[model samples]
Target: MFKVYATTPESMGPCGIAAHAARAEAMGFDGLHVPDAIHDGLLLAALALQATRRLRVGTSVLVAFPRSPMTVAVAAWDLQQLSGGRFELGLGTQIKQNIEQRYSARWDSPVPQLREYVQSLRAIFDSFQHGTPLRFEGEHYRFTRLQPFFNPGPIAHPDIPLLCGAVGPAMTRMVGRIADGMITHPTNTPPEYLRTVCLPRLRDGLERAGRDPAALRLILGPLVATGVDEQAVAQQWEQQRRLLGFLYSTPAYWPSLELFGWQARGAELQALTREGRWQDLPAVVTDEMLSAFVPRGSYAEIAEVLRARYAGLADSITFPMPQDTAQDTQAAAAIARLRA
Candidate 1:
């Protein structure tokens, strides 16, 4: 999971990110996923690579609409080469509002647009490795020029895996066809959602691409709120409820709410957010809604709960950090149990 708490513009320079990465790696996280909200995801990926020795690093998503495919390929290639093949390139088509308003970028046909984006990156990487002239022209992206001076030219690790952050079926299928892995939106995914909605779509995508089912990884991160005791669990749930409310405020992320027949609640939250009523948003998410998404238990039981819920389903689950030094020891024990 991302250390997004420390990822502010002031603090997330090389030193700050390196410290967080070192701490996370020391805690035995297998990978660091950089998020794309306040900070640049690609830049965070680079910093993570520079900071850690053994841990893998990737973007939860680098927004696809703002950056060209060639630019992405260049950065990912350098990170892969520098990190000795431990870089994963994860992309996403962010919501239309963010694309149009936040970035001043155009947004249309995200599914097909992202498909061509991934294709273009692959084509560019291929040209760099094989010395072939880059010639990929799709409806959304065109890359027909690559001078020798521009190409980074054949690193030790050319096959950097491309992962996509997706919630919808069309995007999931596109990921299965072209991407190496898929990151599920935590708000839209629970264990039941994975078994029913996510896995089937992934299978269909793999079948459509004529690829092996085992080739793609199903990455999931349930909202895990683990604590040492009852009081801590209560506090964690409160925190998670606020986060859930914020996510449900986005209409694009209403699938899980829809599943619970709380789409109306989501609409109400959206209206509150539009009126700049951020303080009132958390009230819209009921305790029942919070329980439906987040898994709350003691630190000792959380790993087993996750394994039982997602065994044979998720290739990797996001590692939740313990609150204190005492819980950290317990958390490590839990991680060992999951590995076993």
Candidate 2:
């Protein structure tokens, strides 16, 4: 069956989180992905888990650089156990600047760091499950012995799935080679690019690792806004476009957007940023750009578009809900239509 996953913004208020999770669970959503940004992802996940019983709660991504692997392992394991195995730990290595400036942590060689991080997490989980001594020494991390005091106890299913949020070829392949799934970023990737470029790289990596590509889950991340008012929806899209435009102009994000033929607009977006004319973004964003990136329309139209766009490649399509609106009703209605 095609799965439907909804994305929760990083800054979602407590009421918003509870309301969305409750509605999504009632609406029969497959999962709820909470993004990791300037907020505490684990805290939010705990809240969501408490709020909904059936829905699988996940972190859209928890940056590896911010905290130690041991810390992440314990928290994820605890959450999984607490949620009755209804948790997926989505991991990612954010850009260097965020890692350094925001998290106040070191950033170096993400691929290797990611590998070691996963390995360490697995080791910790294994130690708890099999009652074996856990000791791992990698270039990035080392653990001679993990105390039982730190263990979160056994889970109904100790094997918590790890999903990596990656975009570049190396990271995409790495996700295929190691992670249980890959979560594609929304800034620039189109559905076809995921099917052609990202999926192929992932498949090749899986082949090299003697793993089946079909076993890996593919998650398509897109900014979603749905409303009764078309003009309001368009304005929301414009705001999203400006934010995405700024992201597109960045060195890290530019490469991805450039691949999707969005590089030319980078200069104009940069100019907008320089002049503090963000409100003028709507005028500059062409219809083609909106079609290629942001998904906008009435609830039914947007849901159908998402279903069609994701089609066969993704196991789930994750749509982020805006904060200002009453998303429960719209989300429930959309899910009912999509499932039907």
Candidate 3:
């Protein structure tokens, strides 16, 4: 089945995460994805896991560069065991500035560094599971010590799945090679981007790893604008327009915009941002641009659109829940037919 996931609402506090999880489960959501923004996604995932019985919880995704591999391994390992193997450790190398300035951490070749990071994590998990020595030596990271005193020992669920959030081809290929799944960045995607840029690189990586392309989970978190009425669709479109303008300002994510010869548009947005003209940014994102990022339609039309766009390409999808009760009901019905 193609899994349907709902993102954890940022308005929820620590105690509210559990309630949100329970509600999402009742809504027929297959899983819950907690994004690492201002809040601690790991702690939130734990809370959600503790609350729900069958719903899978994942960090979509946690910033990996800020923490050590051993630290991530321990957290995911414990969570996996606690959740009876329902925990997925979704991680991402969140750009250079966020790592260097915000976290006060060093940043280097992200793809290779992340590859080493995942390998180190797997090695540590291996030691915990099989009582082996912890000795993982890599170019970017090294973990030669895991004393018995610090070890959590073996658990029933030792093979914790690793998911990576990626946009660039190199990082996407790395995900195909080393990760159980790839979480595509919401702002840097479309069906065309997936088929042309992401899939080719991923196929090459899967071939190198001697793995099947169909085996890897491709999770899409696209900006979707769907509603019961024109007014609601317009509201969602406005929100998506502002978001696209903000995201397109980042030059690093210009490839998707570049595909449609909109590199100049990205540059214009970047210029506006650098000039501190925040209000002017949204004005630059035209309706045509908004359509590229967010597909606008009625709630009843969404399922067919999603399948026509992402069928066979994506294994899962994450989107915002409609605020209108009747619209939400129709959307739920449509989403149920996504995998069928």
Name the candidate that leads on TM-score.
Answer: 3
lDDT of each: 0.79, 0.77, 0.85
Task: Put down candidate 2 lDDT per residue, 1-340, tens digits, no spaces.
Answer: 3677877866676656778787668767888988678567887788898898899999989877788988888888888888899999999999887889987898989988998888888888888788778888899999887677866667787989998988677887888888899888876357766667877898988998999777798877777656656876777777777667656555566555576676767777668768997666556667777677777777657778777766677767775554545665776677766656
Residue 16, model 1: lDDT of 59
lDDT: the better of candidates 1 and 2: 1
lDDT value, residue 277 of candidate 2: 77
TM-score of each: 0.93, 0.90, 0.95
Tens-digit lDDT string for candidate 1 (213-330):
8898767756777788778888988988888888889888888777768899989999998999999988888988877788887867877777777777777877666646566677
CA displacement after TM-score superposition, residue 332 of candidate 1 (Å): 2.0
Model 1 ranges off by over 4 Å: 1-14, 323-327
Error of 1 at 239 (Å): 0.9
lDDT of 3 by residue, 116-191 (tens): 9889999999998887998988889988987898999999878787999988889988988989888888766688
**Ranking of candidates on TM-score, top first:** 3, 1, 2
- Per-prediction count of colliding residue pairs? 0, 0, 0
Lowest summed lDDT over 10 consecutive residues: which window, candidate 2? 319-328
TM-score, predicted candidate 3 vs. hidden true structure? 0.95
Q: Please list all clashing residue pairs in model 2, or write none if there are none.
A: none
